[model samples]
Target: MKTFLFRSMIGIFFGAFLAVAITNCAVYFGGQELLDGETFLKNSLGSIFCGWFFTVSPLYFELKNLRLSQQTALHFMTVTILYFSLSFWIGWIPLHLKSILFFSGMFLTTYAIIWLSFYFYFKNIAKKLNQDLENI
Candidate 1:
């Protein structure tokens, strides 16, 4: 419980930082005021929630009965739902089928890349550890 609280605190701050950074970048690059005050607040809060959820969601994997694939799938589904719902609510994405689909594709692609990178990274670490054990 203490560890979870600590992680949640970290996640909230990280999420806030990310939200501000992303917003600033969008304002700078897009060359337009992207959000009014109310919307900006909503976006910021939504981002914090997302950060918290993402950080904590890995706890689901601690369930010994679920396979890795199952854990990943469940996490992915929850994240997708949370992200898109927030996106739409925060007015980041237009409430149109085409826009939703396009964003969904982009999000899925990015998620897959990150997930694969982590998977391979841990796999390499495991392999190296096993090799060292064999040498021992």
Candidate 2:
């Protein structure tokens, strides 16, 4: 539970950061005016909620006896469904085919990079543990 909370909080922060950055970029490029404080807060809160949804999958899949590949597949599917659904709901992404395709591609690529990075990180830790075990 502690780990879950910690991870979720981290996700929330990360998501908020990305949301703000993206919004700034949009405003700059699209020549849109800055959002009102209430609107910005609402959007940020929604983003944090979406972030929690995104992070839950990884924690849920971290069970014993599951292969890394299986975990990755499950995570991918869960994030795919949750992200698209949430984005559509929040109007961050349009429900049109072109928008869907573009966002889907971006999401998959980003998640794949994240998953691989975590995979290698844990693999290195496991390797270090095995070395220590061998020395004992």
* Winning model by TM-score: 1
Show model 1 residue runs off by greater than 4 Å. Answer: 26-35
TM-score for each model: 0.86, 0.72
Per-residue CA lDDT of candidate 1, range 1-136, in tens?
Answer: 8868987998899999999998999899988665788877898999999898888777766778999999899989888888888888888899999998899899989999988998899999999999999999
lDDT of 2 by residue, 1-136 (tens): 8988888888898889877887898799978886778767767877887778777778746676888678777777887887777678778888899998998889878887987798799899999999999999
Against the true structure, candidate 2 reaches a TM-score of 0.72
- Please give the CA lDDT of all the candidate structures: 0.88, 0.80
Q: After the best TM-score superposition of candidate 1, give how far the Cα of residue 106 lies from its true spot, in angstroms.
A: 0.5
* RMSD of every prediction: 2.2, 3.1
Worst ten-residue run, lDDT, model 1? 32-41
- Candidate 2 error regions (>4 Å): 13-42
Clashes of each: 0, 0
